[model samples]
Target: MRRVYSIVVSAGLAPALILGACLVLAVSPTLVPAELAGLVRYGPFLLALLGGVIGWWFNRGRAVFVMALLLICYWLLVGNGAGISAEGLAFLQIATLYLVPLNLLFLGFTAERGVLNPRGIARMLILGLQIFVMLMLAGQPDVGSALYRVLETRFFASTGVLGTMPHPAMIISAIAVVLLLIRHKPLETSFAAAIIAIDAATVMGAGVIQYGYLAATGVVLAGLAQEAWRMAFVDDLTGLPGRRALGHAMAELGNQYAIAMLDVDHFKKFNDTYGHDVGDIVLKKVARELARVGGGGKAYRYGGEEFAVLFAGRTAERAQEPLDALRQRIADNKITPPEKSKPVSVTISVGVCERDEDTTDPWAVLKSADQKLYRAKQSGRNRVVI
Candidate 1:
């Protein structure tokens, strides 16, 4: 159950759930009331706008670009603002069918350098250029017809399972989906969901296209939210919960919980002797051992070269055995520094305290643990004190 929960949350469960709701509504139109007719028409535009604001605020270039693309495509294909000729409309439909997946692939593969950076601006300009060229071709009936013929040409057999989607578009969407799956990060998974939604919009009837785009926009928004949360509460370098998360956990501690403070011994010396890069490797190695700590303890990166473990229902004496084992394991592990022939070992010192009659507050218990940590360092590094 825990593994399942981790997988779902890690992959942006909120967005997936939203997409599933949209799919259900699409299949059973009666579930939607007549009062929601206006919402159904305009919700995608509103949501996309909101998503754009979030992307910009968070400086997530991919989200911003994707939201903009979704808004423009929704406006062009569904809103039909220009009242173009039937041939132009048909051309746009096919063009977007191809362009959406291509844009998704580009955004999925690219790094998020930020929305206002030079590279981001270049990406935006490139997308604008494509739109301009598409509009120019769409205005010329003969050119539009020629391109439409080329785009509509089938590269594979059209089976009943494939519906009426163009083979080329299907192929592009398939490739994008497969690559996104292989990447398997939260943002990449969201992109894969969006591509699938767009493809469904293409193969299904026009009535469902808006829902598909809406789901795509929703997933992007959800991904941005998840990333922002992670940035606030997770240590990027160590991949552990950060100090803010520790504070939250501490707030919920019971009366008998244990708090252990840990610090890498002589970390500054390691950084000075080898380099900051080698120091980083040492910290990562220590963090890995801490993450695997026993006794139902949760590890957190408290700050530079320091970490904390919380044993929610355990006493200080009960926590000593596991903490000592962790210290020994880290002391036994050796790290090979770059350009160095011999491997060097890293060690950590730990101090533990539990809630008691004299120190009932969690903060006080933590402070006591820190004081004990100092004593442990004074006595000798690479040891645990309780």
Candidate 2:
């Protein structure tokens, strides 16, 4: 409940600040015509007080700070020319409300550093506007007019889901992004396509061009493209580089690098006893340990139960010391699997090879490493041999 309250408070700060300013300035008998003062002052004061409490309670200090500034600016500089009539006052109130919710929506969905979520947050917002249009369709004479009516409609409608808040459309887009990240079905195909179509339809049907929504679409598409690249070159289970990625790393390393091929010993037996799920956990643990062990070097999941590590700008002799230390650390570390009594104690067999400008290509170096790995496995499953 406290956390929920905090979220609400954080969410409400901006509007509260804006409304509070309008109320204090407009209601002052000295600041405006007396006939226009009552509603202008009272209505916003109530809202501002409500929003301020929520903002303060929620720890939205940044918002509060900004809101205070906006309030002060408007009151001192813009108040007289800003108008004090009922219609004018209402417009101010509604516009503030509209801006607040939109700001919150952006804050909630954006990444910490301002990278937009690449899954159509914009399209969903437009779809929401379309829904709002449909809801008020009967009351309005034309679609364009209904779409254009946001400034007029915002005050009352902003309280509803389709207004300032992220509507179902936004949520759907977010879900699609998550799906793409996790490789869940429908996200890559039908759902994504449908979202695009709906947004286009809404834009055309309502006769409104939403640039924000288009921008969001672009972001989500970029994210989807990034996801695709990861899928092509990253191991899904451990989120490490894959064989293709290893090749890329080797190319970058050129001739001045050593490669170590790592294979877990008795992995098949371990999987049979622990079941594939626990086996997966063990593999992930091993991968993490290898990553930690490799430090600045690159590690790859070279297909099932086998791994590769590439050390750039290092000779075989230079790589040997850390590689040996890594072997010992793997032997020493306690790795546990899910629902297991003791960690599925494991060690790796590694084969090392270096790329030389005179002789070895990436493939040859890899082949040599594979041969060495075979020798290590053949001799003993728990040792590293070069």
lDDT of 1 at 145: 81
Across 266-315, the per-residue lDDT of candidate 1 in tens digits comes to 99999999999999999899899989999999999999999999999999
Give the alpha-carbon lDDT of every model: 0.85, 0.53
The TM-score of predicted model 1 comes to 0.92
Model 2 Cα shift for residue 165 (angstroms): 8.3
lDDT per residue, candidate 2, 110-203, as tens digits? Answer: 3322113333334335434633443344233354343334544332344433453234434545455344434332113322332332233233
Alpha-carbon shift of residue 115 in model 1 (angstroms) = 2.1
The residue-level lDDT of candidate 1 at 13 comes to: 74
Model 1 C-alpha RMSD to native: 2.7
TM-score of each: 0.92, 0.51
Query: Over 4 Å off in model 1, which ranges?
Result: 1-10, 81-83
Model 2 residue 179 CA deviation in Å: 15
